[model samples]
Target: MRATVAGTAVTLTAGALLTAAMTTATASPPATATTPPGTTASQPVLVDCLWQRTVRPIDFVLACGDGNSRLTGLHWEQWSPDKATAVGVNMVNDCKPYCAAGKFHSYRVTVRLEGTEPWKKHPGVQRYTRMSITYADARPDGFKQVMTYPLWG
Candidate 1:
């Protein structure tokens, strides 16, 4: 009977100690750094799958840049608040006869997006400053192109 009581007391004391430790650990939230006055805080920009359409004419249409490429999928392999590595598939048309009755092809591409800019025409909004694309596999004949912002609008 004495041994049983002692064992019970030890268990209760250990339980009480654990509860007290947990209480003290979470009693207050961690401190955060304050932002300085007149300085803009860096904001994270999430990459959107349909960002292609939003930029239009300036952003290449995946289809051989003949305006026949349709983005089938965009998978983000790695991403942070402001930068990303992504893979995408562009369903392209060979554009025989100006894209009429053209053969459709699938092109695999890897993309990198970086740099941040305050969106023109909109203060306080952020956008990617640069985007680059590389063909993961062989590209269609003479389809190599470089991207420039505000592309041929």
Candidate 2:
């Protein structure tokens, strides 16, 4: 419990820095480009599997089919038109024998969202198309520290 709480703070702090860097690099993006129906952020967003437009979402489900992999306790590092990044913990179920019998585990990870395309469902909203995760420590068995996946629209 203590570790999880501490990790949230670290994630938020890093996200603030990333936002600052993105602001400096992008130099004031168009005021309304990122705004859709509910919010007023100028940077692009990641469309979660549920089809929600999100900026700096606290958590994201990586596996839509089984919910086996997920990123939790996210802190956005930077959010720009071209890219969005965060530091978070990835929780995965290692189904030693089977998913039903699998135990869940958590690992520190750095997540990056990239690419941009107009969302097909919603007008005036752009979504990130790619995602990459790099484990910070203690990755699950038989996996590399880094992995990338194509985010669903």
Candidate 3:
């Protein structure tokens, strides 16, 4: 009878320990995830720059900003790999308004680098480019302007 009572006590102690462990495991708080501040969920404008290795011909397309607004001008500068100076520049100023917002008097500048130079080198990269755009308007309050959207890709 004494042995039976001792065995029952041991069994009850083991069961209590197992129940405590399971309760503690389920009661613990879950991990929380967070995102960086000042980051937005808006979609970015799309632009592409194409370069030919043998021909050294650089071609680009400006497909940024809202389509409702017109682009008045586009400027591009090709920089050497070192980024010390510009090798080529092209500017176009023939854009008409597509919407009722009137002609979007704006200038956009884009820079693209192809191949390697004495100062810099890029390998296995199809296109390396940067772009900037600015808007203008003749308003009595002043020239209403908006800068280019920042993109890091």
Candidate 4:
């Protein structure tokens, strides 16, 4: 998956690059082709910049290259194979003069992760391919209160 990161159009395949670096994600149990669909539930994943699957993460970085944008205080409302919802705070840096001297601001957001596909780095694992952010109030400048983005696979 590839999408805009912190208003910058960027594509990342973190899982492919650093598959063995981190192992903190809570992946679903391995599922084989013969496994019954309803017998077991396979939850999707949210991969972080370090190529780690971030399972119901409380804090997620939106800008992987820099610490400019991120989500914090996430309280998951639902977590399933195809969709996940959460309420959190989006923290964005106001790069007025420059990025180096920017100030960070917070915005309330409701997050939704949708779509599922095989995680190439981790077999038998799936990952959310799309992300939508619905801001409650005081959204960032030049951005919509609500927006959807694609996730890296």
Work out the TM-score per prediction: 0.50, 0.71, 0.25, 0.72
Residue 131 lDDT in candidate 3:
36
Q: Whole-model lDDT, candidate 4?
A: 0.80
Stretches off by above 4 angstroms in model 2 are 1-42
Tens digits of lDDT, candidate 2, 1-153: 999999999999999999999989789653333454555555677877766677778888998889998999999878889898899999999987999899999999999999988778865677888999999979999888899899877
lDDT of each: 0.55, 0.84, 0.34, 0.80
Q: On residues 7-101, what C-alpha lDDT tens digit does candidate 3 reach at each position?
A: 99999999999999999988865211111133221211122322222112233334334343323222324233332112222333224442443
Question: Roughly what TM-score does model 3 have, to 2 decimal places?
Answer: 0.25
Error of 3 at 150 (Å): 4.6
| Pairs of residues at least 3 apart in sequence or in different chains that clash in candidate 1 | 58-151, 63-69
Steric clash count of candidate 4? 1
The best candidate by TM-score is 4
Q: After best superposition, candidate 4 residue 24: deviation in angstroms?
A: 16
| Candidate with more favorable, higher lDDT: 1 or 3 | 1
Between candidates 2 and 4, the TM-score winner: 4
